[model samples]
Target chain A: MSRHRARRSGLLRAVLSLGLLVGVGVSGTMAYWTDQATVTTGQLAAGRLDLTLNGQLAGPGGSTTDTTFAVGDLVPGESFARAISVGNAGTVPLDYTAVSHTNGTLGPGLRWTVVAGGAASNAGSSANGDRTGTCTGGTTTFSSASAISANAAAPTPVVPARRPLAAGASETLCVIVRLDPSAPSSLQGATATATFVVNGVQRGAP
Target chain B: MSRLRVVVLNAGALLGVLCVLVAAALWVTGSRPLVVQSDSMAPEIHAGDLLLARSIPAADLEVGDVVSVVDGSGVRVTHRIIEVSESGAERIVRLRGDANAVADPDAYTLSRAERVTWVLPGVGSAAAFVDSTPGRVTAIGIVAGCWLAVVLPRRRAPLHARPRRRRGIAPVLVGAALLLPAVLPGARAWAIFDDTATVATAPLAAHRVVAQGQPQCRNEGGLFGVGEYVRLTWPHVDVRYEYRWEARHTATGEVVRSGVVQPAGGRPGELELRSSVLDLGLGATTYDVVVHARLRAAPSWEAAGTTTQVRTSAVLLGLGVRCA
Candidate 1:
């Protein structure tokens, strides 16, 4: 009778052990699968941006011209009053701002402002009729603004601007400048600087 | 005490034997099967079909033989031989799939390096499944069960007697039989060929002029180049004929000059001709001379002339001689 009872208990213990092992195995497998699924789905929401710049303008005073960007090279600073067209050929929208990083050292009458969307007619005057002052000694004051639109047939000039870009959209920003006769003679051939800030990221040359 | 110990030991031994058998089976037949995932080889093979393949001797291969070869990236491809050649002591073979209209990008040379063996029809799906997590778990469970049976005490037969013979052979044999399609053509002999020759000299002219040569044929009549000759070789054979030329006074190094030469008469190996021309052009100087040659291959005859294909290779010749 005792032997029979002992055998019954052993059998029950074996069955319970087997059940526990199966339960642990199943739960582990389920956890692993869940983690894998999450990782795969999380990878779907990422993107990147690519920027291209074209053309530069420079002169004794100030100048403007259209430009195109090519792969694997930077624009020289010799160009003044340049027209920069930026293209967004990436999968994400581009939020960008343009700034001049050079010290105010253009000629006595030199001033630089960005004209977004549209041609620069006077080359040195803002659409709002603002004329920047000339250089005092070696120092010239140039400012930039947003709200310039490359999509407009005629763009307005501003100091700081905000622009929203859809993927694959492009905009042309015109650099307008004026050179003062009182400015240093060496300033005539110096390279103007333009800094491109896209999606809060800064890149460019002065 | 003796009787009880004997019973327990016997049970344990039997369980151990069962485990070893299962393991041996899995070890032998587990890794050789593969599943088809694409319809690229349709008509002759389809997606989801199983393929069983085993490593075999390259010398045993023939032109029409279907073989599975792993490429540089480790992806396996099953195709028929289109050409074979030897360069010095090195043996090279070119392959193309039945469904493809063109041969592969480059010839695969296998001397003592690497070779492909025969391919089996459909049988890779199970192997693919076994590679997955769920299948792995099942396999682990089977192993654990065998282990448990071996480790448990058998002096007290739990309610029922353990079967005198375990049926472990069935699953293993079935698995191997399923993979048999991948391994049937174990031993076979293939054809041999002579080594290919290289050009005798560089064919560039000055810094800007290039001269080219074309293989001219003078049969019963006058001489003619590529358009006049109809070269033919047996099925599953690759034949290359070289032509040379030179160029003169080309402006920019980027300038490319292209032309096409086709076979004149339809011949048995005519449809299989593949051609490519290379401009060996030189840089700088006024005239960038270039000499070009075309390389062509015949289609595989193993498919009983069912498929027609052509391929080409080109080279530029020179970089000197100012045009202005």
Candidate 2:
């Protein structure tokens, strides 16, 4: 019985030793697994949207700076036109529109037309010695022959349709203004001026 | 022989060998251990966390799978796939950080992508340091030295000559050192990708129009019954103009004559006015003459030239009338 007891004690001791060693190994593995180091992933940044007219970006409320047009010496039965550049200067695509407002008595006799993909060219004077011009190489999008208000505070839509402009893309608009031949003779030698503003916003929901 | 001591020694050695073999297997499989570095994928994943990543075919990737891709600059970015599409034979993947509001600006085209297989929280820093060249070299040198201390002494010294305490601890130390490089060297470069797009300020635009006209007049005719006329001229004017004349009796404040000259066929800026013969009943009569002109054009202007200086001296009956 004593011999059997001695053998049993030895086996128990071996098992205890193995368990202790296994416990130590597990603890070490846990420590290594829990080991940490500092690392960084590159920063994630947000995108921006910019719409420009003639390479000029728009400010808040769809306003821009240092851009204006001046046309003069207009007469009855004559028309004048010019090309305005519209560009998308941002990284993302955008949609835009144009509006105009005129002041002075001559405004009532003036008619406006807008066409895309056109070039403004002076067509020389007519037989009656009146100034004349044309918008060549274009498709007319909007035109109105009826007289507008003499002094309109509210802006009139030059291009009622809103179109999407791809990033870094540019479009030229041929804007034409004509004086009615039937305008009353009392409107001579007067002046009329107008302002054109183009507004743009980021691309719509995808 | 004390069985306790022998058992302890064998168990330690066995544990050491297992650690070394496991480390070797991980290295041959090309598995990477990556450390999280940004909060772009927060909540589910966090900074300072360690991940075990495995290589997968690009075609096998699906939307919402977290992946790590190397860009042209050799920078590796880990993000979640928001979209997966095929372009010809190429695979295109669009990714975004979980914490970001928008997807990345540029899509990734790849043949293979790394997908995370396991995550060990808060073990990234240690693994990164150990995996680095300096850290790895230093650690390997220490481990090698420790291994030599244990093995060399055993080979040289007789089995009974070695110290009992030293034999019991040496294998455990060797085991831990071998495990160092296995867990720490999985990641080389990991970063969070950005999706930023900025817009510049817009400028102002406007247009203006104008028209101008000037007119002048002259009186060449005199006397009450002889030639009485006024000529109007406007220079540098292209549009047509209308003129009117009125003859008033200055003493009686009565308008005796008034006529409107409609836009007549003439030179663009010239007008001639002739008056009817006046009746003189043996008395001298004085009259005021006034002329007004205007043009029909855009934003028209009024042009009036007043000529109220006509007088009659002595007049006999019938057709005998003289004036100055």
Candidate 3:
């Protein structure tokens, strides 16, 4: 009887101990899991844009500005050219389309032409004695404008170059306008406006 | 000694030990509530409510189920599920609060299973207290005392004495010790699972200028109407905006002119009047442009109580036009 009682007591003690240990383990794990469940996963989810402008203008009257120019009293057959630059300041490469519009005149003695070293040139004249030009260019003088007008019927506006700007990269274009001395000086001080558009297409993560 | 007395004493000790063991299990597994200190969940759960939550298989959840989840900051929240989705084998749940008109910033996904279990209403305050340094030290001292009491030898009492009835108490004491740590606040555990693998790619949209201090604008049938006021009540935070304008050929489902707007302002207050126009290239058509805005705030921890917090949001606006 004593042996049987001792064996039973030992068994009960073992079972109870095991149960206590298991219960403790589980409770601790539950607490740990609760804390873990409260954590969130962080993700990369934002983008930004940066911009910078570079370039200088040179004209017949020795006037210069940052991408702007003014010339007066140019004898017919006189031409001036300025350099303009556009740069990409963003971390991603930018594929952009640059469009230019003009509101002046173009005639026999006064006309504008655009030349792309490796691309096509676009030229158009307005009935109001104004002409607009557009052209696509690549690196290294992608596009150039030639203005030749001496006693031209109207003032000629040069088209600006449109191109792509790689991330952190810049491209420059040569803009030249010509005046014909034979062209009536009445067309003097005629102004041409040029605007450039830079567009970026957002890309998804790989 | 009477058999009944011995049996009763042993049973009581066993029960006490079992309770402690259960508590210890809960502690080790990290199934405890941390108090909420904001009114964001008001009405349903107050700022002081003890939120008992557990992470389970997201697939098991349905819309309208109240669940506790972690947000972008790793802060836990108890909200109602508004959307449930399964992409492949992964499950995701979108949650919103009864007090919030819109869904949360993003979806809460169960990438792993270790979530909350039960919320003991007012027990959060006690849990919070136990999480403090002094409380932890006191708990450790009690546990050490219990250990000493069990290991030390005790004089044998008279077999027929009433006080001898408590001799089987060591097990009960141990069980209570185990349970104490489980209920302590600030316990943490993680679940192991597969990682997030899919990415959704979409084009950027146009920008919309919002007038500060006024209500947010909503688009209905091609017109903007004033809606509820939404502001970055937190000071010194500038909101960044991005939008996409899409016009569909209502009859053909053809999409045109994904106008992307990049605004030029970095101030805290509302500035200019900017419009995102959809170019209906050839034919007149009605279009819906869904705008998703993501705002990131950069507030210093110390300055959090002060000003200069950042806030961001995405709103959808609609436009209608005819092309001849």
Candidate 4:
């Protein structure tokens, strides 16, 4: 009985150890738990700092003119007044600085002064030749146009005023331009083309 | 005896004896074993290796000793001790992993048992399975049948035939070996359960500090208020994590701005801070910022985090003026 019991116990112990060893070996090989989760692609695209320039001009009897206007038969001291609206069409809050540049000889003799903040007017078309406006908002001077730069590459700001333009916000300005009265005879029939560059920078970015 | 047969039997008996001796020694030691759960201590101790550990005085703990410690989240972890600081009655210990290039994110208080005495490789997986529902059922059935085997013969023996004392202890020893892991602390979490769920603290917090490699907006100091993203952090398992945040109307719970944030591989206590300036553009409305983490581990690990209230002010871009 003693011999039988000893042999049985030994066999049981052997089998138990063998079973645990095999179980543990298989479990280690299985290696079930260590895992990783991958997140889907999510790119936080930065908001853009941009603004669009829209303008209209009105002359005698509320006649409107486009941005590129032919002041038809220009004479000495002939002037034009325009109501230009700058709109913030981008997703970020921004500020803008307007500058005037030219590749032609017409920019030097044309004196321009800008005053921002006027009620948006529909009395003039942004396409026609009516260059006079009816805006009496803020008296803040925006900028002064520069002398002509032939073949110019850079558009310099007339006045470095970064006017804050909130997202989807619009600003109307009272811009008045006048031709020099005491002009020389050599300036006759001189066609001057001026390009206004409106640059917007995200607020606090500058 | 046939030479090859004799050799084969001799080899089998030797292996059997070795197996029995090893199992018996493990059973008798009563060494509470903790399983390696992650690859943090890889190469030295692979995942699923059974580690037998006992607490030693922090003062006696030396550098380079691999020790296990519980983090703030109550997760058991093992790392090698690298530094120990002693000031008056206090001892502060710092630990790092052999597989990791950087040290642990947080230093541990010198009050925990960190020294490890023994390691039985790859047995933790088996122990874990045995601690499961089906495993327990099978173990109980085997134990009950073995006990019957020992008792039935004793009942049929003659009056002069007596059961020996060692035989009586053998079954008890086997029973103890099977149930060893069930009695240990911290080992219970590793055991498989039907639901396989866990309760965790809020995993996210709001902050105003800038995170590295994130774009910073400038106009926030004015009317367009600037704020940081809800930061999500964990105490263990360095893996790339995912989370989403939203700004919703406080009164109606309407989502105002929402987006997801995913940061690449991070270690314990490493914060995954993400906030988009465009998303934080709350306008003039007061909204609550709600964010949480999703650890999508097989069954997923989740946490319910807190919310923050933010209000934006008015702005006049034409006048270049910001209102309060």
Candidate 5:
């Protein structure tokens, strides 16, 4: 009994001493260099995706700076072309596209074709500063309108590499809207409006 | 003839088996170990420590993971990932040292696990030394000599040789000798930085100081972001800290930006020695930041009509365990 008691007391004493040493060591005696640093707590916001439309928007008016793309009256088989330029003002590159939505009975009688860099590419790649969004020699035409054509199915995309417009760069698009030459005379009094909607998203992540 | 002898022999056999098993497991896992050589990640990790890292993809890395990557010039750096940018199939990772005040001067591409998962302290110093040319030769000679001393003596002994009285002691001694390497020296370098008094007029009252004691035994990666800010403290009010900051080119290891800060006044709180904002310029090259913290303590005395002083330094006395 005494032997067991002695051993227990000794063990308890050792534990107490260890606990005391650990406490003292943790509370008061560091004589070495210590370092502490933290990153300021904040979330990195995504880059801006601002796309601007300039130049002539083909519509009712010939080449007005007006926001309304109003193509007043067009005789059957007549074709009208207008030059429009899209610029990326944001810091990062952007993927942009243009789509037209029509509302009227004559909507099916019209067809459109888009040619990129119709005039911008003439300046040459090195002729100016910040021309990342400038379009190359690429063209896409929508000949017929589907009965239920939504945004994606009817949109015209810029040329490859030109699709992602670089920051501070612009692309000039020449859109030709024409009334199909085979349109019947039954659509004479029908009026239609084609609204050009441009959409853009940043190419890479934040 | 004794249980003690039987136990020692069994323990030795067990240890040998365990060593082989562990080595095989590490090999199968494809994990590699590297030695740390600087205090850029001090407090969390230290110089003369070995790090076990597994191969992992850069895309899967998180912001706070400590990863090892090669800079543009092919310099291997271990730092925490602060930001990541993806370019096509590759990832451009930006790293920052924990003790740094800013981001790395440049970023690195992460394609492998070189990410640190385990830190084995003090033993790395011996491993590093042994890996060198002269050290390697000396180690091989010692191992070979020890093997010969044991095997040759046993081979020469008769098959029916008389039993030795000290046979039991031999196994115990041999077991102890083999277990010595795994004991691992407890001493590692760490410092305390008290930034509580940084605000001149109304300093924050106090910081919970974790008093790490002197290790009875003794035995050190990178990017940079906006520069990092670092702080170190002296426990008393009468101490001087002399610190030097060096920014070296990762590839050629040339010092580019170097400066030293020696505080004129001795105060009882942590000192902020570096600022977090860094101006590394826009370049693809990476730089490494190294800090040299030296503390000088002076106690006052009376001599003649003026007060004289005795200087004693309270520098480098803690185990590298807790992070400030």
Candidate 6:
């Protein structure tokens, strides 16, 4: 009788092991049940988010390559405007703002303004000409005219109306820089060059 | 043969159990293993580093903490907090990547933020791959393979077979391994949730300064006779600068006239010099009048002085100005 009992116990242990193995196998496919079909939404993959500024004036929908620009040779009451093409080169959408840095004695008298999706009049060229320009139509996203101290301290948003530039989309940024008409004449013949940096971040809440 | 079968079964069981437990624990804790894709945060947290972040109340957050926030487009960004402002029940947080030059352009208003609690450098790439479709398929295949390997072999031998003490420890080891990452979040809760501070900078842009006009030449009465007077006007001038004008006979190379003029009352801005030129002694000879001005406190990168020169010949009686 004891021999029979031991044999039964051995058989029971084998069955339990087999059940555990089957359970593991069944678990893999158990995510689906009867009368159900998998509608694959799509494969999952990681994406990148990036912002690019093309100072080359490469035209609308400009090259997504990165570059820089310099606003030079300005006189009081004169302004210079450049159409910088800002592009979203990454797979994810992003919004961007512009910050200006001035270096030289003439820096104090210079004013920066950025307009998005607008027409620039008498836009200044790199070569010496009339150094005055203005933006019309679109939106005046930032103007250092009224709040010089407060404006200089904070970054100015370019696309306030239709922000969060979609991926693969590019927009023309009319960067208008003018020397204050009231600037003292002492700032003349002295150079104050500027660098405009476009800072981008993932789109924020609506 | 039976000994070999037992070993394979035990090994397969160990692997299968580990995979399930670890995967389940990750899901239960709501932990996401993200692979950083940019070098915006460097040195301490770099691109390709695997980050495990846990959620915390926004009100509990303070400045200087590294957190992950979701943007409107559903993108997760990891950055350090530079500012935190409270508006009623809402918290507005400004963030900047450790490696970025400026704070992020947009601020986040949230009730909760996912603060990074763990970092495993250089492991993000592998984790990213494993999270992909092909990688998940491969993992499932591996688990299924282990299950099959453990279950296939059957032994019909003696009854009351005792399990080895060494074999019993495998489950314990697997349990511990799976529990480490899960338990760490709670065990070192304070260390993982601590906040860190950061700084920001604001800069202004300027336009270029160009010259619209230059110095000119005119005739003026001198001590000796009718002399050539040169007027030099500069757009930029400092209070401490002094302007000097000198004329030399081009033919004989002799210094004709030289004098210094001080700025009026230590004033800054447009400075001018009006000086009469002395005759070249040689009748009707051409001479060059040059103005040199120096700034006492000019910066090291700038030229200490500026020079302007104009060439002219005597016109109205030997000292008359006639620029050619």
Top of the candidates by lDDT: 2
In angstroms, the error of model 2 at A196 is: 2.8
Order of candidates by DockQ, top first?
6, 2, 3, 1, 4, 5
lDDT of 2 by residue, B1-324 (tens): 233334444443443344344345445665556666655566577666777677888888889888877665555667889999997666799987785434654689988888877777766665555445554454444344333333332223355654533233345546545544333444533444222221221211111222223335466565554554555555423334455556667677577777655553544445454443443423556666555654444323345455544554443212321222
| Cα displacement (Å) at residue B235, model 4 | 64
Q: Could you tell me the TM-score of chain A in candidate 4?
A: 0.58
Please provide, for model 4 over A1-206, each residue's C-alpha lDDT reduced to its tens digit, 9 standing for 90 to 100.
Answer: 36575557544543443444433333233223221211111211134334555521211011122433334333334455555666676666767666655444445655665677755332433222122434467665644444534343654454357677788888876655554554443444456555555555445431
| lDDT, candidate 4, B1-324, per-residue tens | 122322222232333333344444444763345665544455677656677766667777778887767666554557888998885555677776665433564777866464678776666665565544455454444434444443443333356745534543344455545555432211411210000001111111111111222212222232332332323333333232344567676768878667655555554322322333323344555556565553322112233544555554434431111111
Please give the lDDT score at residue A27 for candidate 3: 34
Taking chain B only, the TM-score of every model is: 0.37, 0.47, 0.39, 0.40, 0.44, 0.48
> In order, what are the TM-scores of chain A for the candidates?
0.42, 0.67, 0.41, 0.58, 0.54, 0.61
Question: DockQ of candidates 1 onward, in order?
Answer: 0.01, 0.05, 0.03, 0.01, 0.01, 0.08
Task: For residues B116-172, write the lDDT of model 1, one tens digit per residue.
Answer: 332334433433333345544554554455345434654554567453333233343
Per-residue lDDT for B61 in model 1? 52
Lowest-lDDT window of 10 residues in candidate 4 chain B?
B192-201
For candidate 5, the clash count comes to 32
- In model 2, state the lDDT of residue A134: 81
Best by TM-score: 6
Worst 10 residues of 2 chain A by lDDT: A37-46
DockQ-based class of model 5 = incorrect
Per-candidate TM-scores read 0.27, 0.43, 0.30, 0.29, 0.30, 0.46
Model 5 vs truth, CA RMSD? 42.0
TM-score of 3: 0.30
Can you write out model 5's per-residue Cα lDDT over B1-324, one digit (the tens) per residue? 223323323443333333333344445775555556455566687656766667787677778888876554434567788897886656788876675433555777646546778887655565444334444344334333333333332223355857534432335336545653342211112111100000001110111112211112111001222222333343332223344445555567776666654545543333332322222333334445454443221111101111111111112431121112
